[model samples]
Target: MSRILAFIFRRRGHGRGWHWTDIATWIWLIGGTILMFGPALWLVASSFKGPAQLAEFPPTLLPYVQQTAMVEGYDAPLPLYTTTQEDGSTKVLAEIRRIGVNSQMVDPGNPGERINVNIADRSPVREIGLATGNYVEPLVKNNFLRFLWNSVFVTVMATLITLFTNSMAAFALSKYRFRGRDGVMLLIVATLMVPLSVILVPLYSVVNAMGLLNSLWGVILPTVATPTGVFLLRQYMLTIPDELLEAARMDHASEWQIYWRIVLPLAAPALAVLAIFSVVWRWNDFLWPLIVLSQREHYTLQVGLNTYAGELNVQWHYILAMTVVTMIPVILVFLFLQRFITTGIAGAGIK
Candidate 1:
């Protein structure tokens, strides 16, 4: 009987422990999800609100009321007469008489009277309203379509160039058995240690000398040869079997054929991952493009977004709206290629 009681107690304790662990895991998962997506949710919500709703006194989490104000004629000082009665009652007679402007009095017998007032002009009070005009006006005024095109053009071109350059370099390092190969690999790895800022001035001079400044190629060319890309691709390429290349060689296949048919297809997952990285980096790049490109027609989406923030007043709602729009493409790209990123990284161990 005692043995039976002990076994039952142990089983109940183990079950309770598993239940507690499951509950803790769920709490952590839900909290993390909320923390990650909270800002994105807020930005989307604020995009629909106006400046007043955005800058409401003691800010509102959700916009409940729309505030509107209009300017009316200014009020002038008027005279008032106070009379005391015998019973301690006071009567105040207020006349609508302007101190600065002239007024015309009408006689009780006369119905029509004309008057002209020559007074100092009061400054006009600006009216504030909660309207969608602020958000719509900027997109129409600023050529947003052109800015978007520029962003896509730069990102796509730069990403393609980076992928091609990095993949080729990676393949060479992985498959070739030439002298100084290790030294070359070391040199490329060493570049990852050097910050790009150190070479910015020299790079700028080179680009300027080549007359690439103010051109889209200027932005695309500098970022094409990335050390990180080469490193990532090389690591993945190491996993490819040399016997495959030898087999292709026995079939009288050229190096280009081996790369295109055998290696590239095998490396698709890694290439996709690299392409995603390159596209995202180039798309969101702001400072380099701002420095290199001067023309309004050539400005990328990020540079164009900067124009919304002015010296005196900033259009926060418009800025947030544009930001939300800009992030959509990157998010979409990530969603499309996320499988590649995860699978590639995981399969890296296999190779």
Candidate 2:
């Protein structure tokens, strides 16, 4: 451990000792790490706490519950507490019941007699405990698996369609020089400034006219053609030499063959970047899915998560637990494809 710490703090370039820049860099990194991961850690911790623990003021860092003991002649376990006696010594006692500011406690060893103590004179004995039920109960009671499947289907289908359609649009816009092509590209790019909220009603009308309401296809089809994706892929495809396509054409290759064999292979990094973006966007989208799918059976994960909130109460434990579950896929996708992001974005602007 000491050697590892020494190596970590070691100065680069044969410096004799630590420098001020090194100290600042380490401080900045540590602070950044805390800022990034602290809320996630807190969410995980809070997910394992029961309602009582969650409702406590100035929440604890770890899940905690009052310790309980099975006292003699009691049918159920009783909560334990440490009470300060008249002689200023403390004794562990099991609580029977509380009335007003006083509590009736019993010695676990001698359960026949009850001792009265002021609530202020005693504090409940608590130990770290995880409420696994927060994770289990929701799965058992709700249609969690169906919701997960719907989300997965939407994300996968939408990503594939986004990649295919965007790449095709990009191929044409970049390689082909038809009249009004610049105007077409400008119109597509300009759509980025138009917020989704502005088009929701018209989009919904189109989906409704097509009889796609309450259908997963409605969610997947409407969002597959994204201007951001077209822009990204087109910019990247522009960097590919036109000579490559001409060479393929000279070898008796069709346009589709050249696109499939030459262009896509070279633009893999950009496609990967677009794929990651599409997956995240489709998976986390809530409003469109909520508006389109009225039936509970067709609800996606984001829409399904809202069911935890009732008119009078919100089941935060279930919400937090399921939220953690929902994040696992997005996190895994990012970790898997994160390597291509820098390369793809940089290469896109080279031309």
Candidate 3:
């Protein structure tokens, strides 16, 4: 009886006893994953799609491979159909559009022997040529590789600056007690409520005053003093016990040494989390970069990608292809630092 009962409840300890709520949780997770990843998958797929395949009747997920579908008529694009020629011999005729929905066969080399084929009795064989020019053409024509390099430079520099400044500020705020420190902290947190748009004009004026206009330095400098980053680092740093710092101090470690050696090493997890956020923020940054830099050579990947658009038509294939390329760094950074984010957030938030 015990064996029988055990066999019946074999999964009891495996997944918290497998309630209906577990099924609901799984449904929600699968649904959320699809929702988040579907559009990104579509964008990558669309990058490889040909122009005709973009509007194909039955939507295709994979890129349409260039294949020759038979062309029915003449070299000049005509529909093919079976028609009886002069000797009652059947010849295939390629059709040309006529008035209304009607179509007619082009006159053969001899205009006098016009093939007036029936509207319903033609079996047209195919001859459609396929082209896959989008992916390679844009990169070659638009100097996209240079833009990619510029984007990489900007993202790396901005993330490094933000990490250094934010972490230093966080260490001071979290580890030290000073007169008016609470007020300074309050002021920094208060900046979070103010949107960047509200101060754009002033910020630009400041950048211009420093003679950083139309430079990468202009774009990188303004973003370094992020209030949110300071707050996040402070929260994470607060979780590090003071006893560790005191021991270092007893060894005659200077304030800067204590911060550089002791605090930073212990705060690696939080720094990793911050680095991920900083990379994503700087990588996707477009507006400021656009406003600061005007020269084509200096343009980041996002701004340079705008050159593909025109008043007449937008080249979606180029846009999609470049967008996928631009996203690679952010995805890689997240993957590298993802393990630290959850743990750091929990430690910082709870402490």
Residue-level lDDT tens digits of model 3 in 26-71: 7798899999989998887787776666767786767755322234
Predicted structure 2: lDDT: 0.89
Q: Which has the better TM-score: candidate 1, or candidate 3?
A: 3
How many clashing residue pairs are found in candidate 1? 0
Error of 1 at 300 (Å): 1.3
| Model 3 pairs whose backbones collide | 70-126, 70-127, 71-126, 71-127, 80-124, 81-122, 82-122, 82-123
Model 2 clashing residue pairs (backbone):
none
Which candidate number maximizes lDDT? 2
Off by over 4 Å in 1: 1-14, 18-29, 61-136, 342-351
Q: Tell me the whole-model lDDT of each prediction, alpha carbons only.
A: 0.72, 0.89, 0.75
Per-residue lDDT tens digits of candidate 2, residues 11-60? 77878688788889999999999999898878988999988888889889
Could you give the candidate ranking by lDDT, starting with the highest? 2, 3, 1
Better of 1 and 2 by lDDT: 2
Over the stretch 190-299, how does candidate 1's per-residue lDDT look in tens digits? 98777657887888889999999999999889888898888888888899999999999999999999988988889987888888778888989987888888898888
Question: Regarding lDDT, does 1 or 3 come out ahead?
Answer: 3
How far residue 278's Cα lies from its native spot in candidate 3, in Å, is 0.2
Select the stronger candidate by TM-score from 1 and 2.
2
Q: Clashing pairs in model 1?
A: none
Give all TM-scores, in the order shown: 0.70, 0.78, 0.72
